[model samples]
Target: MEGTPDEFGAYRLLAGSVVPRPIAWVSTRSPDGVDNLAPYSFFNVVAYDPPVVMFAPVGVGDDLKDSPRNAIETEEFVVNVVTRDLAEAMNETSATLPHGESEFDHAGLDRAESVAVDPPRVAAAKVAFECELYETLEVGTSTMVLGEVVYAHVADETTTDGKLDVEKLDAVGRLSGSLYATTRERFALERPD
Candidate 1:
């Protein structure tokens, strides 16, 4: 089906109806020693062999966002999982802060040093992936930063027989503007043999 030819309208419609998007609660350390924390909806696991994850920072108004900048400059970052318990604090970090200012301090989040990367992880996060910057791709005004997972931390409560229990994780997701969702009910689908 053919739709309207305006980029703004089309993009808005696409973003609005994408069901639920997993949020990447990203933390990065600025060059001047400030820690930054923020959430990005445009995130996903890209590869498993090298264990790569990627997130995109959409250019607001005109310039690249802080997460992308810090990841590129520092070559490291931590992607924290947004669980129901930390949803409020996660939302607080989404506020637009002035460059060089840290959302971690703004949101009053705790920090823990990563084992494999310099960027710290959110102390209260249910799961955290410590990553080393693998690549950065500039797409129009936005920037996609890809990283290789060097270490991971999962809350003890969320682990069951060497696997993460989604119910215990209680992960939150992004849904359009000012809308959020949680992983309360889930189902498993298997491919036909």
Candidate 2:
């Protein structure tokens, strides 16, 4: 089914069927040192050899989002994993805040220092990635920002036997519209030998 769609129609279709997209709760620091936080569903890890992660910030007509703008300016940002417990606070930071306003303070989310980046990580998140912006690609009306992972922090309690315990992390996912989902119940399948 080959079809051409206007921006709105294409976006709606893509957002609707990208089931259970992982939410990247990004924290970025402005050049003036103010912190901003927001969640983006158009995010995923693209490669492992160089540890590349991609996130798309869709422009509102022609304006770029604050997070991507900050990343472009500073070349660093932190991606925090959203858990069920922090879903409400994560959603709060999604509100449109004035430039220079700290989303950490506005949303009441705690901030923690990163090991390899200037931007701070969300303190309550079970997992956090401190990344350095590798490149910014202008695709149509969206900006796809690629990041090189510089450091990763995983809560000790959430790690078990050298693996991240998904159940213990209680990660939250984004759904269409204003809906969210929790990874409370999951089934595993092993690949055939």
Candidate 3:
């Protein structure tokens, strides 16, 4: 179970070991106004004080992917939460289209204008975070993008007393390969004081 940290081996190990990771359905707009959408499994919340989130996107070749490239160039992006109902569309957006191609069109998804960012968000998402590029880190073949959320959108159906209801949200998570996990079966455990 040990070997050199080569590209394929390392990725397979890490991706397989991480039981279930949240998918960041990110959207960005190219400088030329082309809207880009893609899903990144290597994503998570980084901070709460400033409400920051991070997503790591790997390059397709020598060039960067549209999501990261657009965010870097325009300094804005949106993270749309993928739910069970939107899983198929989210997967469609993951396809590597020609640079500047609109994933929204390819997936037949609708876009909604973001409040604090230029990039549009998926209209069907239950929750969306409008972010401004806070920082970027180069780690091997991936570019880690840290974004400070300036605004947020939450669907009324997914909220209870202004807080997100996980059951109602019904979010989906990314597993290894083409697998996905659901939030349908969940249990609560109170934290110790």
Specify the poorest-scoring 10-residue window by lDDT in model 2. 1-10
Poorly placed runs, candidate 3 (over 4 Å): 1-8, 60-62
Once fitted onto the true fold, the runs of candidate 1 whose alpha carbons sit more than 4 angstroms away are 1-8, 60-62
lDDT of 3 by residue, 33-73 (tens): 99999999999999999999999988633478888989998
Clashing pairs in 2: none
Q: Residue 45, candidate 1: how far off, in angstroms? A: 0.6
Mark the regions of model 2 whose C-alpha exceeds 4 Å error after superposition.
Answer: 1-8, 60-62
Q: Pairing residues by index, what is the TM-score of model 1?
A: 0.92
TM-score of each prediction: 0.92, 0.92, 0.94
| Clashes by residue pair, model 1 | none
Residue pairs clashing in model 3 are: none
Cα error, candidate 2, residue 108 (Å): 0.8
